[model samples]
Target: MVERRPAGLRHSIKKQMAAVFSLLMMGTILLCWFINNFFLGEYYISKKQNAMFATYQILNMAATNGTLSTDSFDIEFQKNCGKYNINYILLDAESKTLKTSTPDYSTYSQRLLNNLFGENAEHQKLLETGEKYEIQIAEDDRTATEFLEMWGVLDNGNLFLFRSPLESIRESVKLANRFLGEVGIASAIISAVIVYLISRQITKPIEELTGISERMIHLDFDAKYTGKSRTEIAQLGQNINELSYTLEQTISELKSANNELQRDIERKNKIDEMRKEFLANVSHELKTPIALIQGYAEGLKEGISDDEESRNFYCEVIMDEAAKMNNMVKKLMTLNELEFGNEKVEMERFDIVALIRNYLQASELLCRQKEIEVIMEAKKPVYVWADEFMIEEVFGNYFSNALNHIAGKRVIDVKLNRHDNLVRVSVFNTGEQIPEDSLPHIWDKFYKVDKARTRAYGGSGVGLSIVKAVMEALNQKYGAVNYDNGVEFWFELESAGEKVDDEKGMETEESQNG
Candidate 1:
């Protein structure tokens, strides 16, 4: 089954990062707005109070020095009043104006007198009190405006009053908070978009890695992480690439091992089947010879063949049966070695034409005794590559089989024909055509088409089987073909061509007359 990601998690990292960054920015802006709303007014008032106290100290010092009306004192006092946005009025012990920064001195003096006498106290909130001074937030009854006011008695028994307007400061604080809110909202939106874009850049590699892992799940190891950065993400990509390579190699090795194991299993099964078939064929083939040998020996022991000729025939029959059994056993051993790969083939360059002629020459007497005509068509050397001894065995089996089955025209034809890079040696004999169905089984051990005829001629039916084994060992082709006149058996070997040096100086004569 395919794996799937949770619905909520898809593409969430970018969004989450953008959200978190925007929240932090907006939170900082909100905190600033909150401070502006709750504390800015008090801070402004405190700074104004400090300015007023400094001015008062300067004025008190001047009055003590009797320089309150001097030009330098007037200049300094006027500058302080303007800088602190304060309006001040000073009165003598007789209630006459001594120095004033505002033209409305009478009005300020009345207000100060009212404050000193505790009149209009219900309209004032006291902020601080001292032996010589008191600070309060008071409202102007006519204008409904508030002021941060300081009134005190001078050392000379004179009165001084200082006041600054509080309305503008409150408006500034509110305006600042509103402006912060506006900027914070705009910054949050723009920062969110920028953060989202940056987050996509960061998450792109992670998404690619996820895709690679998905492909790996399906056993496809082709996808790879190609990022070249030195970040942790890049390191992870390199690790994943290595993991993919390792897994691909491991899986390939496993598949190879599995295939080898399967081949071994099939080979084992084939060997077991061949073994069973071999045992059955061997038992069947040996039975008749063993029974004959036993029966004849028993007759001799019982005096059933008392005559000298009869006794000699009995002994000869036993020896012949024993020899056949011995020959059959040797052939069986040779076949076994070839089939089991115990016998190694020695490949060498040799003239196939000369080999055939020499074999026919060796069997010329047998051919004459059978009164069969033998024919060979090649007159030149046909050099080929093969295991010389094994090829000879193959040729010998074909020739013998053809001779044993020779009939009708009583002629044997041996031909060496070349096709492409191979030489085909065919042995044909005039005889009854091998049955079509039995042709396929002719190469099986101990499979005879006519059992009675095979027994009459002492044919063991293992020659073709040996031929099959030898040809297979040499990795060549061998087969039989049926014609109207007879059957032709053929085998092929790799051609060495006439260019090879004739080390044996062997030459083939024209067609041999039998």
Candidate 2:
């Protein structure tokens, strides 16, 4: 039974975005409200101070010009005081008003001049100390009025006194509260809309990447990021796309390896069975030779054949069997070397035609003895890449096999045909074709169509196996073809060196016939 995996925690980018943007917007709104509530009172007081300062600056400027008692000074004084909404009094050193902006301060039941600087102990300090300036906020509980008092001594020994009411401030703050409520509502709505749009814009890629991730989790690799922006999110999207490709490739390889692993398991089981059968075949093959050599040796030792000729014949039989065993062992070792890559194939370009011609010349004696007819055709300077010694062995094996198996017309045809980038070298003998069923398996070790005939030739049945292994090690192709009334065993080698041109090939044809 397949076990179920637990689902993991999922984070929603959309909800997180909404929450973050909302909190940010709310935080800004709250900070603005808190500041207005805390500092509005101080802000109003600072404005009154600035107005009073302007009035004082006008008087100081007139005195610096030595024009304090002039009509121009009074004009400048009235203009500055009115502009800053301050009521001013110009007082002489005796503390009596020489000029005043308002003459109706008696309505408050106090002589304004004395009440500001003379009556109040704190206010008296500005009059006594030379160059001393002071500011005071006085609240009138009866009329619910707030006023700022500023007094300073002029450089000309004249006293400058000023007052600015803050009556409008309380009313302005009330109006501000009402206005802020309405504005905040409108701003919140606008901000919410803007924030929502912004959050969507930000989280869109995140959501898409999440979707891609979800699909990737299910092994769907087709979806891809299409964003063209150069943001970090865009880069992340590209990385996710790359991750998808990598995961797809890795999974495919793993699945392929898993299938191969299963096949290897099956093949291992079959190999064990084949090993048992192989041992039986080896035992069978060695048994006959051992029995013959042992019987012949015992016969010689026991004087079963008393004559010298018989003794010599027994020795010959024993030696022949021993020699066959030795040859078989050597062939087995060569095949092992080829199969296991122990045989080093030193590749070199050589004239293949010359190699074949030399091989035929060496076998001339065998051809003559067998009364075999020979046909040879090739192109001159036909170069090929191969291990020369190994190729020579291949040629020898085919030629010897043909010689041993020749029948009927007794003709052996050796031909070299160039096919594209390769040269097919084939040896053909006029004899019975191999059975169709045994064609593919002919290259397997110890496979023979005619067992009796093979035994007669002392064939270990590993020659074609060696041919297959050698060709495979060289990464070349080799096979056999059944022709009419004969069989052809062939192998190919890579064509090397400069190719003979068409014009040169035609001219060399006559010289190539051998």
Worst 10 residues of 2 by lDDT: 505-514
Clashing pairs in 1: none
Taking the tens digit of each residue's C-alpha lDDT, what string does model 2 give over 302-331?
889788899999988899999999988788
Runs off by more than 4 Å, candidate 1? 1-247, 263-271, 499-514
C-alpha lDDT of residue 500 in model 2: 46
Q: After superposition, how far is residue 428 of candidate 2 from its true place, in Å?
A: 0.7
- Record all residue pairs in model 2 with backbone atoms less than 3 Å apart, i.e. clashing: none
Instruction: Supply every candidate's count of residue pairs whose N, Cα or C atoms clash at under 3 angstroms.
Output: 0, 0
Kindly list the per-residue Cα lDDT of model 1 for residues 95-208, writing each as its tens digit.
889888789898999998998899999999999898999999999988999999999998888999998989987988888888889988998999999999999999999988
